[model samples]
Target: MSSYYGLPVLKEPVWKVPDVPAYLYLGGMAGASSTMALLADLTGRRHLARAGRVAAAVGATASVGALVHDLGRPARFLHMLRVFKPTSPLSVGSWILAPFSGLAGAAAASELTGLLPVPGKAAGVLAGFLAPAMTTYTAVLLADTAVPGWHEAYRELPFVFAGSAVASAGAVGLVAAPAQARPARRMAVAGSALELAASRRMEARLGLAAEAYRTGRAGAVLRVARATTAVGAGLALAAGRSRAAGVAAGACLTLGAVATRYGVFEAGRETARDPRYVVEPQRERVGAPGSEVRGEVHRSSSDGDLQ
Candidate 1:
């Protein structure tokens, strides 16, 4: 591992632990819950639909709060909303979040207050239409960074996030409306399967970057995430009208989702902390073998000449 006196090649991400992870988790949950709400409404599962709407609203609101807290002020979040750059993931995410939040709140309010039912349903449908992008755009946002673990896994990260989102939303449904949770159970199973498969495939394809996910704190959390998600899925399959089993599965799934986000964040930080992750990839890109590159230290003289 060649480096300048063992210093990292890339700066660590400025994102904080709990806040950023919470934002990611809540945004995903909100987006997918909106979709679940729409689906439940269409299928005449009124209770499940109402539950989904409330979850979406609360999640979106909380996600925004988390983001603002991380930014250190409310103005910074509002500053982000001033620009609408289509090419920037952050900008697009802000736009998506802004409208989605409003729509979700409106829908939830209407469902709860029994006012303006028609417009509320319309808002729910619109929010549902945007839900897929809302759920997965954070993956794009993370992948857009130079962090090796996130950038290298870009191909599969969106799928992983989407699956996680679906699973989390379904878990909420199971916990909130157990009696009408048939669709939720199926969603939980399917989403967990997808999340596991995508995550495995992402790790396998990450090559050298995969180490970030298999070693240190990141590895420990991800292992727990996988185990819990798998167990949750299995429990969901057998739950079948058992409220206790469903609630237990939901708890496991929620924990798994939270762990996965934190694990990914930690992995990216780990990759950034290691110069090898940055140097080796550059070497490969430039047709140089990893071992051929050597680190050299240079000092500047008083006259600004390198020595």
Candidate 2:
């Protein structure tokens, strides 16, 4: 087979992966719902809070659905919870997702029938509980993989993923429930800021691997991510007055964040295929005994056998 730019072609998994991306979207939607739910309830907007709870539940359910469908054996999805391993991000994610799903489900049901006491209050508490994990654990999920860019950028990726999740959740709220757009706008700003800051920090620490962000197709993606995040965050400053602007910024941030994830993923794969990253680090690590200077060695994300 002819090579694409002479790069070694690694076969991606053969199983027909569903639109795995929807999982990411659902995650963001659930996370945003939690924030909005709590804010609305706290501010005496019971109707708004009810709406957020329903949305959170629906979004969380959808996220889980997408994740399951993406697996080669969708039925085995339940096995995610059968055991526990801290080193495995998926196992941890399953735990994080479990409470959220139960809570969101309860909250959503309460909204539909108002059949129970303290529907608004219970939902608010659940939303508050799900908010942080919804934002953060996604990073862990991807980071725990043997994937290239993901495993390497462990520290900042969680924050980046969290930031993206928060931003997207706000975007969904803007689309599905506009009345709570103010809190949504505020969250978009915070999430974008955190996302940008974390990405920048990763770019700084990853060094040559950081080139993944600054080069070729991946570079273009990173640029868009940075630009949208910056613009969206700036737009949020005065968004309280203009719902339309908030909506637009939220959408941009959401799309941009997704793009960043894909770009980083592809870039990491590219890094992995090359011999340079694989060879150099080991060379430094395999330095001669008793040399004048120490040459500490480390593995590159590519073929460092660490994946």
Candidate 3:
């Protein structure tokens, strides 16, 4: 083994890079607005729908800033749209995010006399059209990653994230109106269930890639995150079972869900930065059942301390 300052050098790359902050901001905005808008419109709460629209707009705009900031050079941001690159997942999402943000904004704005000259039915129709896809695209953005944990758990990662996004925004809705607490609970419950189902599968199905969920600072955070989201989300189902439980569930569950997202983000970055995360296990996957994993369970240089 080679050594970089007495630390054994592994064969692959460790992606300790933080997630694109823009994606973080935009993902929440897009998710919350989409769910709240759909629910509000269905419940005949035009006001909530409008609020959802505004949040989405603000969220989208903020996201663009985050995206631009993530780049080394902000001026060249337009280059993202200059080409139609299916090979690029971010490219696909940018296109989708741009238009969906517009529709959600317009739809939400229609209820405001100041934003629209004539508040009419077309806005509702357009918003309805954009809502579903808006809910789904964030998952695709994440799954598109080449990172082992992310790309390998492709089938369920999107839904797991989509559920988390809705839960966060729905928490906002719960805080906004007493009337919404019931439905908000439902959203949390469903999203939590889906998130856990996907997550468990991610951990169980991907032997090595999913190692991000089980070890290190990021992994430790992820375990707590899962517990929080699970307990919180499960309590949501019983919100009708008790008011105090409902309030506690809503607040805790929402926090837990958000924590899960952040934890995964942290873990992925850790996995990327460590060559052991990238190589050793992958090699093991190809060898026979009992083959030794080439590089995993990092034995840090300073008596096993990781960064």
Candidate 4:
């Protein structure tokens, strides 16, 4: 094997901070808000339903702005939609985001203006249907890349993102609509638990490749996120009796979710900088006893274990 000690195994992600993380956070909130709107409408919680719709619209719209800004040009984003590739997460995500933005905006407008009630309800339903993909596809987009921190955590990343989405939606609902507080609290607690568990599991499963999550600035951010998530979820579960407690819980959840996004982004970049993460695992895979063929390509069967 050729030895190149200082060379990077993969290119660092070209995405800028704040912009990419903002896009991720807003996209997730958009999806979660759509789900909240649907659930609130079904349960006759009009205030929450209206707030959820509005939040969905705002989040979706802002997400597009963040995405376009990150792309550095509106034309590039427009060009991305020129083709639909089933295997390309960016292509599929763009398509999902487009309809989702329209539907969410329409639904919120109808609620705000009290016009076209039937069409608004239909739009909300459609947005809810698309919300899962909107929230989870970001995870898929990251995992589809060659970054060790991302691709190696594919299995758990979806759940982590989904949980964060639900938690964020719950936080927004709690802060925006007092009537649906109970369900919102429940969602926050459940979502935080899921996020924490999935993150720990992903790190554990990554084995040696998980260093990016353990020993750097990314690790510090993730550590804070875990602490805040735990504290926030605990407070949320017990926040029913006091408005102050509820708001505090909501703020913590929002903070934790943002921290998680930044930490994940940083971890992926850090992983790409280290060559051992790229070479060692593949080397072991190829050298394993009873391997199919000498120097044959190795496919990992371990869940979320990347190349």
lDDT of 3 by residue, 143-254 (tens): 6766666666778777777777677665555554445566666677777777788788778887766777788876887788788887777766766636577667767766
* Better model by TM-score: candidate 2 vs candidate 3: 2
TM-score of every candidate: 0.93, 0.79, 0.76, 0.93
lDDT for each candidate structure: 0.93, 0.70, 0.64, 0.88
The reply for model 3, stretches above 4 Å from the true place, is 1-22, 25-29, 72-74, 112-128, 238-250, 285-307
Per-residue CA lDDT of model 4 for 1-307, tens digit only, reads 3337777878888999899998998999889989989999999999889888999999999999999999899999889889999989989999999999999999999999999999999999999999999988999999999998899999999999999889988888778876577778888888898999999999999976688898789999999988888888888888875778888888899999988888998898887888778888877776888767432433443443545
What are the RMSD figures for all models against the true structure?
A: 5.0, 6.2, 8.2, 5.4
TM-score of 4: 0.93
- Candidate 2, overall lDDT? 0.70
lDDT of 4: 0.88
Ranking by lDDT: 1, 4, 2, 3
lDDT of 1: 0.93
lDDT of 1 by residue, 202-225 (tens): 999998999999999999999999
